[model samples]
Target: MACDREVRRAVSGLSGADAKVYELIESMESAGIVAVPELCEAVKASTITFVGFSCTFGDDGERSIDIGRHGFFERKTRSRTENLLSKLRDLEKDVRFTVFIDDMEFRRVWGWSRSQESLTEECEFQIELAREESQIPGDWDVELWSRVESRIECIPKVCLNTELWHQINSGVACAPINYEMVLKWAAEPAQSRALDEIARMRQTYPRNRNVKLSELRASSVTGLAVYSHAGEVLEFLHPGAIFIHSADHRRDHMLGYRRTKPLPIIHPWR
Candidate 1:
């Protein structure tokens, strides 16, 4: 009964083809003329219904069954109907759901939905680009150093007496400079204390990192320089970006950077 209530709530919000499929499932459950337990259960699991129905009974092409039409019930036998229900149930547990849906029998069904093909193609293109970029000499290290040099040239030079800077200059190797550590060595005590507070605030609210970093840059008079063993630190820098000088003992060590698209915002209700 709880599952039925959930199914009813889900059905109330759905529209277009998804709503129609659930409507048919609701009709079958209430009719009591046939025992379609699998269909009834599928309706109760909203995610299962949302993903399975469009994947299994897509509305495209000549062979596609029009569940929207009243004649569909008359055309399909009880056994055939049960077989389709069983297939939908089995699909929920299948590890290769994508492969199964791409099969000829189900491929047409996804016509109304977003094309998984485009996503696959975009992923493949990025992989290819990475592979090609890796073959270039010095990889992204040269580019990172060039950017760092350019930024440093534009900013005023202030002597850094921090232990981290000493470790880097002495070639003893040191951890990459982070926001919290970077502010402790600020030239002016007042600016240093303010930056430290911003860093603390960043810990409580992560989205504020960029804003805090911007404030640090606007108020600071010196370039922030630090050493890293790898170039991956660029990914973490926010507001004004920084290039970290990195070196490794291995002769064949290659460093690279891959720019990724920003993640989509997810809504809690969805």
Candidate 2:
């Protein structure tokens, strides 16, 4: 089973955190939510050239990503594109309302662990066909349930638990490997605002590459995140929100891969 083919390809070097960014692009592309322009915007650059799809015949986007999040990257049998497809499905399912997800922020919560399904899975797995809206959390609960393409067993704690979220985030600087720029940003008190600003900044001033995270300092217990074109990364900074990313979700940065409309795996986004 050769890789179906790469629908898209991207290269990055901003920081290792970008490994997550590349994965995001792969997910979006495989999921059919992203194109060259969209990917460039998401990853903070128009410079990204796409590599065609890497999947083979008969590999549906659903099939490519059919394996649960873990099956994408953890297992050696599935290729990376397939892993991306799997995560793409997860992303569309987990935080459907979440229009924008930072690469680093994505990893913070969903560092890729084997567990039960998500709390949201409740509505999806019910034996009864019709579920009462009152029993669900929000208005679009039913719609959310309907979109649960695949289900994985995740416990309520792992799904909704945000107990050590901040504490774990603050430790990002101390992680086995942290971004030097993020470390520098943690020192500035006024930098707290910058963290939120950082996510959006990359999209706009990607060419600047002058705003050093080390220059800004943050005192409040907030999360900061970034992405790079590197490979195989875990952990990311959260901007204004905490516990925003889904746990027991895609390790897109660290794991997750599946594909549907496989790309050509082109070298650059020509």
Candidate 2's displacement at residue 93, Å, is 31
Residue-by-residue lDDT tens digits, candidate 1, 1-270: 975675466557665544554454444332121112333333344443111111123344423332211111222322334343454445452111100011222222233344545433433343344336442112111122223333433432122224424433343333433323432434345445444543444445455455656554443322221211122233222211211111111111111211121111111110
**Model 2, span 180-241: residue lDDT tens:** 43344443564455444543444344543565544322311123322211110211111111
C-alpha RMSD by candidate, in order: 25.6, 18.3
Query: What shift in Å separates residue 260 of candidate 1 from its native position after superposition?
Result: 31
- By TM-score, the best candidate is 2
TM-score, per-candidate, Cα-based: 0.16, 0.18
Name the runs in model 1 displaced over 4 angstroms: 1-142, 150-187, 205-270
**Candidate 2 regions with alpha-carbon error over 4 angstroms:** 1-181, 195-223, 227-270
